[model samples]
Target: MDHREIIQILNEKKKICLLIDASKYATILTNDSFKFEECLRIISKLTSDLRIINKILNKKSPKDKITSLTNILLQLYGCMLALTNGDVSQENSNDKNNIESNSIKFVKGKYGKPLLESSMPIKFSMTTDKLFSSMFLTKGLEDTEVGIDVANVINYCGSNCIDLFRDIFTEQEFNYLSTSPNATTELQKARLFTKYWSFKESYSKYTGEGLNCAFQKVNFGELTIEDDTTIKTYDLHDDIGLVLNFYSKWIDSNRVLTVCYKCSNDHKDNYIVHKRIDLRDVLNYLNGADIFD
Candidate 1:
C-alpha cells in the first residue's frame, strides 16, 4: 500500500500519536544510487537536529568515509524517528537535540548489552528482520529498559530451522511442539520457530547485545494465557533483566508478521505500542493540515 493508505489505517486505530517511516531503510540499503551526498541531503531534510549529524560527520577524518558513515546515521535517525513524536522537515532546528542527547547515548553493559546513557528519561530498543522492523519506545517510568523485534514467519518455515534451535527451548516448549496434534507438522513447526526467533531477538535487543549473545543460553516456553504465544527471559551478566513477548499474524496465506517486545517492570503502563505502515497522515498533521481535510 501507498504511504497515504497506511496513515489512514493508523489514524483510525488511534493507538499512537507518532509514526516513523522505516520504509526507506530497505530501499536505501539495497540501492546503488544511494550515495553519501544523497544520504546527507536526506538527513538534512529528515531532521533539523544538526548537532548529532555534525558530531557524526566531524568525527570521520577522511572525507571519503562520509558514504559509509551515512549508514550509521540512518540507523540512529531511524530509531529516533520511530521512538519520538516528530516529523522530517527542513525548517526545524536541534532544539530537541538536548532532550535526546541526555537519554540516547549508547554504551556497553555486562555481557555487552548496549546500555543507554543513564540520564535520559526514557529508553528504546528495536530489531529488524528481512522486510520488517520493530521498535519499542519506553519512558523510564522507573528505570526500565525496553526492546522490540519483528520478522516474517514464512522465511523461517522453509529452512528446517526450528529443529536446529531446539536446544534453546525449555523442556515444556519441546514437548508441546512435538506432541501437539496440530494440523500440518510443517505449519506447526513454523509457528513454534517464529515464536522462538522473535522472542530471542527481542530479548537480545532489550539487553542491547543484539546477536552477540548466544540464543541457546536463553530459555523460552509458551505461556498459558495465550494459546499461540511464547515468552522468554534472559539472565545476562550484571543486574540487567530481559523479557520477551511474541505474537504472529498472517499477512497472507504464505506470509506472517512475527513481533516481539522486551522490557523490564519499570516500563509498565508508561508507554503506548503501535504498528503502522503509512505515514502521510501524520506528516500532513505535523505540517498543519486541517484534520477535517
Candidate 2:
C-alpha cells in the first residue's frame, strides 16, 4: 500500500509522519473519555517520575482536555513502536509492567514538557479538542523540537470559544478573533477558533511546556483563518522573538491540522521538506514488517 511506500521513503530520508483519527480513540477506550484519562493517571502513578501527572494537575484543565492529551500521549507511544519497536500488539497489556513497555517513557524537561529519553532522535507534539486527537512525530531532526496540533473545525471551537480561550491570545490576536470579518458566520467563527488555537497549541508543545507557557505573550502575527496552507514567519513572546513557523491544512470538512517547526537559517529549507503518510501504513508496517526492533 501507499503507507508502506511512504514509510520506506521516510525511513530513507529521515522525515516524519503525523497520525490522526478523531474517533478511534474513544472507541479504543470504550467511549468513556474520563476512563481513558484515569487510565493515563494510573499509568502515571506507576512512573517514578511524577512530572507527567503533576503537569496535568497543574494545568487544572477541564476533564475533556485532559482526556484528549492523554489519548495523544498513548498514540505517540504507538508511533514510537512503529518507528523503533515493531509488532506492538504482540506485547499488549495494561498492567504496570506493560505500562512502561507498551508506552515509551518520557522524562520531564526543566519546564515540565515530556522529553523523549530514547536513543532515537524524535520529537513530537500532540493536540486534542473535546472531539478529536492528533499527534506529530519527526525522525532525523537533530537538536530541534517539533510541535503539532489538530482541531475539529466544528465542535467546541466556534465563536462561543473566543471568551473561553481569550487568555491564551495576545491583545492583538484577541481583537482579530473577536472582530475579524471571518468571525461572522458560525462556521467561520469555528474555523477562526481552530486556526489560532491550533497554532497556539503547536507553539506550546513545540516549546515542550504544553499549556504551561505564557501563551498570551506568544504572537502569531496577523493571519487569516482561511489560509489554505502553512504560514511561515511566526514569532515567540520575547522582545526579540525567536523564529517559528506553522504549516496548516484542512484535511477534510471537519478537521484542520497544523505542524510547528523551529528552523535556523541553515536548516530551514531542509526541515520544511516534510511528508504526510497514511496512518494505515504505520499500522501495516507494524503488523507486517519482518524485521523488528
Candidate 3:
C-alpha cells in the first residue's frame, strides 16, 4: 500500500503490518566490501538501541544475520515513519518541513519477543525467515497486547517435521495432525504443521515469550485443521487471557502467516484488526542504505 493508504489504514485499523522482500540485498551482502559492522550501525541509528545492535551481532552467520536484521530495520523504519508523517523520504530531504525520522529501537522482552525500547505506549513484533520477514505494530493500550509471526512452510516441512511437530505441539495437537482430513500424505501433514507452528509462534509473541520456550509448552488449545492449510479455530484457554483474536493466511503454499493478538474482553471482535501489507515506502527508503560500504 502507498504511504497515505497505510496512514489511513493504521488510523482506522489501529494496527500496521508490513511484509518485506529482502532478496534484493543478498548480492550486496555477498560483496567483499560489504561491512557488517557499519551496516548495523546505520540500522542502529534508526533503532537507537544497543540491545538491537548487540543482539543482531550475536548471530552465527554474518551475511544471514545482517540480511535478517535489515528486514526488521527497514520495515520498522518505514511503518514508524509513515505513522508519524506521510512521507519517509524527508528523513534526508532538503525540505525543512519534513520531520527527521524518529530514533527507534528494537529490543527483546523478557520472553524473547521483540519490543519497542521506548516509553511510548506502542507495541510491535517482528519475524524473519530466510529472505522474508514481517512486522506488526499496534497501539499498546493498557488492556491489550499485540504479537505477530510468519513461518516458512517449505523450510519447516523439509526437515524431520513430524518429529519436530511431536516435540513442539501438545499430545492432542499431534493426534490431530495424525488424523487431519488432509493428512493422508506426508506433505499435507507438513503444511498442517506450518499453521500450528505459525500460530504458536504468534501466540508466544503476543504473550511476549517467543513460544514460551519451544512452543510445546504454550498450548494452542483445541485447534482443528479445516482442510490442509486453514486452521478452523485458534482458541486459547480462558485462564490465559480475557479475549484472543487471530488473523492468518498463507502468503503462498510455501509460506504461512499468522497474527495472534489479545484485547480487553469488554472490546468487541473489531477492536484490533490486522491487514497484510507491503509498505512501498519502506523498501524505497532502505534501497539507498550503504550496506556495501
TM-score of every prediction relative to native = 0.55, 0.64, 0.74
* Candidate 1 off by > 4 Å: 1-36, 40-105, 110-118, 157-160, 183-185, 209-219, 223-272, 277-293
For model 2, residues 26-101, the per-residue Cα lDDT tens digits are 4545456565455555445434455555555565445454455455444544444435432223333112234345
Over 8-80, each residue of candidate 1 has an lDDT whose tens digit, in order, gives 3223322222223334443443344344344444445444556546754675433223323333343344334
Which should have the higher lDDT, number 2 or number 3?
A: 3
Residues 238-283 of candidate 3: C-alpha lDDT, one tens digit per residue: 4443356676766666777777666444333432333444323453
> lDDT (0-100) at residue 103 of candidate 3?
60
Q: Which residue segments of model 3 deviate by more than 4 Å?
A: 32-41, 82-102, 106-108, 118-120, 140-142, 157-160, 211-235, 264-293
Q: List the residue pairs that clash in candidate 1.
A: 6-278, 103-120, 114-208
State in Å the error of residue 131, model 3. Answer: 1.7
